[model samples]
Each structure stands twice: as C-alpha cells, then as structure tokens.
Target: MSWQQTTLGEIADIVSGSTPKSSVPRYWDGAVAWATPTDLSRLDGKHLYKTDRTITEAGLNECSARLLPPGSVLFSSRAPIGLVAINTTPMATNQGFKSFVPRPELNADYLYWWLRANRRQLEDLGNGATFKEVSKAIVSRVKFPLPPLTEQRRIAAILDKADAILRKREQALTLADDFLRSVFLEMFGDPGENPMNWDREPLSLQAEVKIGFPFKSAEYVEEGIRLCRGANTMPDRLEWSDTRYWPVSDAARFAEYALVSGDIILALDRPWISSGLKVAEVVQADLPALLVQRVARIRSSVPAEKPFVFQCLRHPSFWSYCNPTETTIPHISPVELKNYPMIKPPRELVAAFGMIAAKQSVLRQKVEQDAKDARQLFQSLSQRAFAGDL
Candidate 1:
C-alpha cells in the first residue's frame, strides 16, 4: 500500500454557511438540522444524527447557509477552530462553520478522524490574536496522509466499534450514578421533607464547613498544586479536565482549607443547574489542595460517617434544599447552607448508605477504566489504518 499527503482542497470542496434573518418566522424554525460548535462537543460518533436547532428550507434560500449532504464534514472556523463532525442528515450550519463535501475517492469517516487527530494543527492555522479562526483558504490547504478508500472504511468500522463500546460503558456509569442517587433518597426523605419523627440537626453540628482561599488568575501556573474550581465539582464526582493548578507558593494561604482525603466540596451559586454542587473525595495523594473561591468544603466531623454524608449530598433531595428561588442564577448562601438540616437516621441506616455508596464508587471507577481502555484501542486502530498497517 502506498500513502500520499495532499491538501484538503485536492479532495474536497470547502463551502461556507450563513444564517437567515431572525425576524422571519418561517425561516426561524424548520426541519433542517442547524449545527453549532457546542453541539459538536456532544456528538457520540463520526456523524451527527441530530442538532439542537433546526432551520426551514426558506431559511436556506434566504441565507448563505447551504444544505450539506449526509456525508459532508463540518468544521468550526471561528472563535476556536478544528472541531469536526460528519453530517448524517441534511443540515445547515451558522457562519462559525465551514463544510467540506468530499470527492468520491475520499471516505468521509476517514476525513473526520484525520481532522480530529490533527486538531492542534488547525488551531495553529488560526490567524487572529484575540479570537482564533481558520480561513477557508487555510482549511482547504491542510494536508494529511490518505490511504485507499477500501482501507478507510475498514479502519473507520474498527474505530466505530471501539467507540460504541466506550459509549455503552459511559451510559452504564450514568445509570449507576442515578441508582446511587435513588438509594440516598430512599434512606433519607427529600431535603424539603420535615420528618417530624426524626431528629433534625444543623450541618455545622455534623461537619466542619470552611470556604476555600481566594485565588487570583495570576497565581495559576501550568502545574503545581491541584486546584478545584467551580467547573471541577459535579453532582457525584469531579471532572478531571476541569481541574486547574496553582503555584506552590500560594498553597500556604489555603493550607487550612485544603481538601482532606474524604472532604466534600459544594458550589454555592444558584438555579442549581449552573451551581457545581458535588461530592468529590480527594483520592490523589497530592490532591490535598485548596478549593478555589466560591466553593465550600465540607468535612465530616466523624471520620466513619464521611462516606455516608457524601452520598446524602448527591441526592436530588439535597439539591432541592440548596436550589434558590425563582432567580436567574440559583444559589444558596453560606449562612443558608450552615442552617440546612439533615434528618438523623439510626447509625445502622447511615452505615448501610455508606456501604452502598462505596460499592457504587467501585463500579464508577471500573466503568471509567473500561472507557479509557476502549479509547486507547480506537486510537491504536486509527493510527494503524492511516498508516496502511490495518
């Protein structure tokens, strides 16, 4: 097998898109899928099956937005470029995207994967200092190693299968998280439920609550102390990609508020959706770092009951208590949080909840590991395929 490097323009026709007038009702909402960069992030496969917004045929004619065919590749061109997804349906995109309709000799899937693997190169092509964008000419001139069409399909199928397995594992993780939440609710009534039969206690009585240090942007360095931001904290776990770092010199100021091995961090902002209230146990040896400002750290006063409280914090009932009233940003203040009450159950019941949480944590870890392995396998196959070694 022989491989050749050629510019995208040699094999595909690059087309730009436009949006229709907002005032025209007919063009505002129609059946054609309309895609944006945000939608690209949620895509599960090489081809996007649906989009958040749909445009009308009238809109297509009214604006420069063209109706791209099923196999055309879509790439973001503005703000940040290089994110790519294939269209599985006839769709139109905003000016932020540039569509590529491949020639018959090229495989759409192969092109999509190639673009993803070389995303950094595309980002480098961005010319603006403030907002990076890939010009149509620059995008068309980008080159890559291309194999025969037959090989491309085979390689794509292998990667697709691996990716499918990873997606299934991810779905399983979501279900497990839901089940854990259900268990927490069953053991303890909803946060709003005032169980007259059970003893009520302030959160301060059961745990030590402390706010994190105020970290200025200048204090952030490439790698030093692990820092937890609002984005890092989620409902049940911390998002690794959301983790940031701070210079070690700033660590002393946050030493008292540093997360212990079992402490839980909660975001205090409101409309619960945007708030990053979540329970993240400090598992990493070096992660005993401070939580950024706007986050509250909760550590169980009783060491044996830490996991139990962590589970309770993840319950939907708990979120109900913290969720703010009809406001644009849903949030609960530190004062409100300190006074929030928990229904005191028997010691055995608390232990049972802890056991369930521990089991769920194991399952979550396994699921994440499986997903990581699947991704590695897919990447290996992709590399071989592009190299004509498949």
Candidate 2:
C-alpha cells in the first residue's frame, strides 16, 4: 500500500476549545453538549453522544466554542493526553482539546485511530510549568500516514469490527457481574434496607483491616518480591500493569503488608472515579506481592465465610459511603472502613450465595480471557494498518 505523508492541518481544520464562565448560571444546564477530557475517559463506545455538562446558546456565543459536526474527531490535549473519540452529535469542548474537523479526503474514524497510534509523539510535543499540554499549533503540525480515502475507510471498518468484538466480550463480563449482584439480593436482601432482618455488625468485628508498609524508594529492587500499588487494585480484580518490586531481604520487615489468598484490598486514596470504585481480591496467583501504602488489606477474622463478607463490602451503598464526593481526593480511612456497618445473614445462606458466586467466577474468567484476546488482536491490526502492512 502506498501512503502519502501529510500534516494534519492540510487535511483538517484544527480548532482549539474553550470554557464559558462557570459563575454564570445561564451558561450551563442547557441543551448543547459540552465535553471535557473526563467524558472521553468514560466513553463506552466509538461515538461520544453525550457529556457530563451542557451549555446554552448564549454561553456558546460568548465563548470561543464552535459547534462541531457529527464527524469531528475530538482529541484531549492535556491532563494525560491522547483520549480520542468522534462526536456523533454536534458538540463543544473545553480547552483541554485540539479537535479536528475532517475535510473531503480525510475520514474521521481514520483520524481518530491515527491520533491514538501517534499519541506518544503528541505527548513529546507537550510543554508546561504546571501541567503539560500540547497546544493547537503542535497538534496542527502532527504528520500522519494518509492512505487513499477508500483504503482509509476500509481499515477503519476493520478496526471498528475488532473493537466491537471487545465491547461485546466486556458486556458479557458485565452481565456476569450483574448476575452475582442479583444472587446477592435474592439471598441476603438489600444490605441497606435489611428487609430480611439479618443481624448487623461492624466490619471490623468480622475482619481485620490492615494497612500496607511505607517502603522507601531505595528499597525497590529489579525482580524480587512483587510490590502491589494502588494502581494494581481494579474493581473485582488485580491488575499487574505498573507493578513494582521490593528486595526479598526487606520482605520480613514488611511482612504485615504481605497479601494472602482471599484477602480483599481497597485503595485508600483517589479510590473513586467516573467508572467505579477501586477494590480487588488477592488470589493465590497474586501472592509473593507485598502491599504498598495507600492500600488497605482486609481479612476475615474467622477462618470460614470470607466470601459472604466480601459480597457485603462489594455492595453499592458501601462504595457510596467510601466515596462521597469531596473537594480533595475521595478517601476512606482505615477506621472508617473498619467501622462500616454490614448486614450479616445466616452462615448456611451465606454459603449458598458463595456456591453460586464460585460458579459465576469461573464463567467470568472465561469471558475476560476472550476479551483480552480480542484486545490483543485489535492492537495487532492497528499496528499493521499504520505500518502499511494491512
């Protein structure tokens, strides 16, 4: 495949976004879709149809915001850059973006993929004293591999199909998660309502909330004991990306933070985002990893019935208590977590729910594996398409 190398400015109009005065009441809560980087981060599909905020006609007229058409490609330029999405409806964004209005020759979806492929280059262009940002000038100067219109559309369609497969697999996993919640509701009733008249107990009565060790920077080693940071704690699973290690010699000193099988870990700081809470379970495979500070490890005081309490902690109301919106980072102290109220059902009933959860866990693992494979294939296709191998 022959590709033409051209700057983004030549094929598309680069527009810098702006914000309206927040103090003005009429400026917001209106019909126009006003977007930010957060909206792109929370996107679940290819096209961004809505946003967290909206602006009125007066606000749009007063600000530098332009009404972007359906095919305009939005690129976040700051606050960890390179979240790319296309607008399905006309929308406007804050100054965090440097969006592109495609011309006759360029396809919006193709440009979205190009921005993602070259995100590192865009980050390299960022400059700032406070937080780094790539200016509109820098964005306009980005050169991309321009394939023929027909070829561009073809590649975009293929990548779209691959992305859809990943989405469907993810949806299956979500449904499996929902099924567990349904089972919980059926067996125990709502933890908040306590309609079943189950006995109430402080979480600390059933489990011990242990904090991680404050390991020094010098204590880090190449490949010794795995160090689990806050980033490793995902919702319902442990994510290994950005994992660190500590020397085995220091393991004894931090032995209290050593994670065991069936231990539940919760992120103590910045735990809440637009997506969900940050909590995970330490499986047998995740052992030999020392828990780092800002992560709290919870273990049942009793030997049996741990899964029963795990589901209680996973309750929506529990996360709400842990993640009440605040001006600073949303956090739940060890004391607050330990003292959390829980509705405990009978042991036999708890065991029954655990049995069903165990079966669902097996199904979830299979779906997750499929999703991972689909993502890997999508990435491979993206690399090949950009490298002119597709």
Candidate 3:
C-alpha cells in the first residue's frame, strides 16, 4: 500500500462553528438544524441526522454558523473534545466544534474513521485556560496519512462491519439486563402495585441500611485500606479503577464502615444514570475496604432473603417511588430508601428464586464475555486500518 504524508489542511477545509444569539426570539427554533457537543456525545452510530435544537434561516445569516452539507465530518473541539460524527443532512453546530469538509478526492467516511482512531491524540492537543480546547489552526496543521481513494473506502467498509459486530455484542448485554428484569417480574409481579399482596414492609425491617462515613481527604494515604466511594458503584457491579487509599492503622478506627461480601452499596447522590441505578453488590474481591461518604450499604438480616431484597431495590417500581426528578440533582435519601415498599414473600419461595437467578447468571456470563471480545476485536482492527495494514 502506498501512502502520502500530508497535513489536515492539504486535504480538507477546516470549519469552525458558532452559536446563534440566545436572547433573540427570532433566532431560535426554525428550519436549520443546530447541534452541540452534547448532541454528538449522545450518538451510538457514526452518523448524525437530528439535533435537540434548531435555528431559523435569519439566525443562520446573522451568526457565523454555516450550513455544512451532507457528508461533512464533524468533530467537537471544546467542553470535552474528540466526539466525532458524520452528518447525513445539512446541519450547523455551536462553537464547541471544529468540523471538516474533505476535498472531493477524499472520502468523508474514511475521515470519520480516522477521527475516531485519533480521538486520544486530539484530546491531548487541546489547550485552554478555562477548559482544554483545540483551535482551528491546531487541527489543520496536524499530520494525516493519506491513502488511495479506493483503499480509503475499503478500509471504511471493514471498520463499519467490525463496528456492527461490536454494536450487536452491546445489544446482547442490554438484552441480558432485560431478561433479568423480566425474571424479577415473573417471580414477584409488579412491585409497585404489589399485585401479589403478600404484605408490605419497609426495607429497613428486611435489611440493614448503613450510610458511609465522611472520611477526611487529608488522612488519605498512598496505599493500604481502599476507600470505596459512591463513584465506585455501577449498575450490578463495582469499578475500583480510580481509588483512594488510607494507612493500615486507619482501618482500626473505621471498623464499622468496613465493607464485606454480599453487601449492596448504593450512591446517595445522583444515584441513577442512563444505564440504571448506581448500585452494586460487594463481592469477596471488594472486601476489607472502608466505605466513603455519599454511599449506603444494605445487608439482609436473613441471608436467604438477600437476593429478593436486592432485586426489590433495583426494581423499576422502586426507582419510580424514589422519583429523583423532584430535586435539581437526582438523589435517594437514606430514609426514603429504607421506607421503600417491599413485598413479603415466603422464605422458601425467596430461596427458590435465588437458585433460579444464580442459574440464569451463568448464561449472562457468556454474553458479557462475547461483548468484551467484540470490543477488543474492534480496537485491534481500528489500529490496523489506520496503520495501513487493513
């Protein structure tokens, strides 16, 4: 394969975006589609066709915003740079973008993939006082490895197929989540309506809800006892990649806050995300860790009832009962979570359901593995494609 060394400026016209005046009533919500970095970040696919806001023709003329024709490769430059997408329709963006219009000799889809492959490099290039930003001059002057037009299209095609497989694997994981929720509904019925009417009890009576202590940052050490924070909690699992630690001597003073296996931890602040609640089950690997503030731990009095109680807190009904929308920052109060209505099922029934759930998890493990493999495969191909080995 032959390649040519060229700057982004030699093969593409760099375009900077601008926002319409917000105060002008006539400048808002019209025929022109207007987008921002937030809009690009929300996309699951490479192409963008819609935006949350629009602007009038008069607004477009009044502002620096220019209509980008279909096939333009858009890249966000500020307020978290490196979100890339290809436009399928005419669109304009806010100042948060430094987009590209490739020369006729260049394939737009190829450019989009290049942007995806170099996101980290672009992020590193961003420089600003308030928040990092990549100026138009910086982007235009960046090095670009150019291949033949035929080869560019072929490379894009291969990546598109790999991306499709990666997306399907993601869908499988999502389906696994749905399958678990369905099983919950089948065994217990609608938790909100308590259709079974077995009896209602506050969560506090069924389990112990312990709030995490406010460990002072000044006392933090380089290693030893790990501090489990609200940020560590994820849906159904815990992520300890970014962790803080305390000295071994510090553990003796915070014995009560020490975490153990089977304890369910929930975030007290912004407890829910697009994926679901910020709750996780503590496994043996997470033990010997001390809890941090803005987190709560729940443990059942009867070990047999553990699975049932965990399901109840994660149920859609319980989420609705919390109604996090009432406040500016969505949250769940300890009192509110403890008082969440739970159905009283027989101990034998709960135990039987737990057995079934454990069996189902075996199948979910396969789906999770497949998803991980798909991610690795895509990453490898992306590296090869841009390196001219595809």
Q: Which candidate's lDDT is highest?
A: 3
- Winner on TM-score (2 vs 3): 2
lDDT of 1 by residue, 1-390 (tens): 567788899899898878888888999778888898878876766678999988888888889888889999999988558778998888989988988999998999878877877787788888887898888988888776777788778777776787788788778887987787687667765645645367878888778888777788876788887787766777656676756788787678667867777788887653244333554666554365678777888888776578767766766667767766556666567877777786677878777887777777788778878877877877787677667777
Q: Write the per-residue lDDT of candidate 2 for residues 1-390, one digit (tens) a residue.
A: 569999998999998898999999999999999999999998888689999999999999899989899999999999978999999899999999999999999999998887877788888899999999999887777777898999999999988898899899989988998888888888888887889898888888878888887878686888899888888888888888777899887689777888888889888888875556788878877888998888999898654567777777888888866754564766778888988888877778777777787777778778988998998998899999888898
Clashing pairs in 3: none
Better of 1 and 3 by TM-score: 3
Ranking by lDDT: 3, 2, 1
Candidate closest to the true structure, highest TM-score:
2
Q: What TM-score would each prediction reach against the true structure? A: 0.82, 0.91, 0.85
Clash count, one per candidate: 7, 0, 0
Against the reference, the lDDT scores of all candidates come to 0.77, 0.86, 0.87
Sort all candidates by TM-score, best to worst. Answer: 2, 3, 1
- Candidate 1 Cα errors over 4 Å, as ranges: 79-83, 127-131, 193-200, 215-224, 231-235, 239-255, 267-279, 315-332, 383-390
- Backbone clash pairs for candidate 2 read none
Q: What does the lDDT come to for candidate 3?
A: 0.87
Q: Per-residue lDDT of 87-180 in model 3, one digit per residue for the tens? A: 9999999999999999987899889989898989999999989999999999999999899999999999999999999899989877877777
